[model samples]
Target: MEFGVSTFITDEGIGAADLGRALEERDFDALFIAEHTHIPASRETPYPGGGELPRIYYRTLDPFVALTAVAAVTERLVVATGIALVIERDPITTAKEVASLDLISGGRMVFGVGAGWNREEMRNHGTDPATRGALMDERIRAMREIWTAETAEFHGEYVDFDPIYAWPKPVQQPHPPIYVGGESERAIARVAEYGGGWLPRGNVENLGDLVAKVRDRAGWRVPVTVYAARRDPAVIESYAAAGVDRTLFFLPTQPRDETLRTLDEFTELAKRHT
Candidate 1:
């Protein structure tokens, strides 16, 4: 399995270009960054990890801008959105941003997407929490249309548009690869329908079985990438043995020196599996 790093590239952490170069120098295959447009103060959405939300949740750099910087600085590292919240974004603008990033990066973009957990955050974006999944599905389909069609248009329940022109189609034909992020049956179904890969968190139950379930439901060999944020080498080895295509280790949000040290630690751990 290939190895990479994923993190909330925050304002306080290592800068994108420097971090990207360091990751490339360490032989990491990719750098996936997370995003959150804004955090609402009056929030009842408990974090998925079960505690107060981390400071990094509200402090991430815009994934496209950061990943673009990463792509500019590195030749081999794939710059990716670990889970760009499609539910909270406009499909047309997002589609253009993605295509432009893919073009600028010379085809090095992995569009990992998810319907997020923060209800308040989505609500602040004018997204109804109850119907966000359906909305996200429509948005993704619409984005696909925008990426591929010459006079792109989508008429869907949530996303609608007329035939419109979009420029700089991605270097990767038909658009960059998409990996759906979530640990739900609905997410698996989405993968079966449209995703090029699956991005499941590493700490889930019976991962081998879950991977099998996704592949079985898809009726094809879908590439599996575990977002192994727990930073445990043994579990990552288990993921590898279970036939995961790639595993991304968590890199903490810290200053450049601390970030580099963590990268070195992750690099050492990755050597066991990569």
Candidate 2:
């Protein structure tokens, strides 16, 4: 099982290029950052992790831009979005962004995506929360078409386009892996139907059975990657037993040395299992 770190990557935190080089130097497997295009002033959606939502959520740097900076400095570290809001972006433009990043990073992008939670935030982007899932699905399907075809065309409720030539195909064959996030049944189905892997938010429930069910239903053995945000080595082993392929440890702060210390500690702890 590979070990990685998930950080906020906000404007105040360690810069992307610095963090990327640090993670690589530490021998970490990957570095991931979460996304929120912009947080609304309204506080309707309570943070899943509790307490006041940290500044990082509102202060996050754009994932693609940040990842690009990281990619420029690192040779082997996997740079990824812990979760990109697919419901609020254009599929064609995003496809091009993913392809360009993959080429720049030598195919080391993991396109983690989610429908998002804040209704007001989605509304700001002109996306209705009621249809976020459907929109997300269509956007992903359209992205796949763009990445895999020389001249791609797609027609769906949320994404429709005529055949057009898109250039700089991703370095990884068929494009970098698209990992779907969230725990809903629909989320699992979406991953099985279109994604390269299942990215489950860390929770107490045993997802082994659900993972098996999704794979069986899809007829494709997609790997499961656990967020493992606060889980210990024992818990990680349990996830491995449950067939998890990779685990990401969450770090919500920005202090470079402090975060790096945590990474070193987790790296040592994770080495026991590897």
Candidate 3:
């Protein structure tokens, strides 16, 4: 399995261009960044990972903007959104952004999407939390139409548009690879319906079984990418053996030197498995 790095690119951390260059120089396969438009102060949604949410969540730079910077500085490293909240974004603008980035990066873009956990954040974007799954499905379908059709149009409960022109099409033919993120059965169903790949959060105890389940449900082999994977070589090796296509080690938003050191450590650990 190939290895990559995923992090929340915050205002106070290592810059995107620098991180991208560093990852490419180290022979890493990709660079994935997380996204959060803005954190609601009401604190209604509990952190998925538990306890207080990290400061980086509130200070993250726009994923497309940050990945564009990464694309500008590196050639081989895949630039991706670890999980762009589809429910929170307008499909037309997002489609343009994805296509433009894919063009700018010479087709090195992987669009990772999720329904999202923060209800308040989705509500703020005029998205109803109860129907986010259906909303996400329609939005993704709409974006796909926008990316591929000569005269794109979509009419759905959540997303609708008339036949219009969107340019630069995308360097990756029809569009960039869409990796749906989540661990639930419903999430897997969505991946089967539309995604090119699956992005499951954290280390899964029964990863091999999960991969088998995805294949059985999707009726085809679906590539699996595990995010926030442990930096242990044994753990990575186990995942590789379990049929994970890529494993992205999570990096904390830290100063350049410290971040680079951590990258070096992870790289060394990954080398053992490769």
Candidate lDDT (C-alpha), each:
0.90, 0.85, 0.91
The per-residue C-alpha lDDT of model 2 at residue 235 equals: 80
Give candidate 3 regions above 4 Å deviation.
none
Candidate 1: C-alpha RMSD after superposition: 1.0
lDDT of 2 by residue, 135-198 (tens): 9888988988999999999988778899999977899987899888887888877877888888
Which 10 residues in a row give candidate 1 its minimum summed lDDT? 228-237
Tell me the TM-score of each prediction against the true structure: 0.97, 0.95, 0.98
Q: Compute the lDDT for candidate 1.
A: 0.90
| Model 2 misplaced regions, further than 4 Å | none
Per candidate, the number of residue pairs that clash is: 0, 0, 0
User: Which residue pairs in candidate 3 have backbone atoms (N, alpha carbon, C) closer than 3 angstroms, thus clashing?
Assistant: none
For model 1, residues 1-274, the per-residue Cα lDDT tens digits are 8998889998988999999999999998888899899999886988978878899998998999999999998898998999999999999999999999999999999999999989999999999999999999999999999889899988988998899999878899889999999889899999999998999997887889989999999999999988855677778778877879988888889999998888889888888775
Give candidate 1's TM-score. 0.97
Candidates 1 and 2 compared: the better one by TM-score is 1
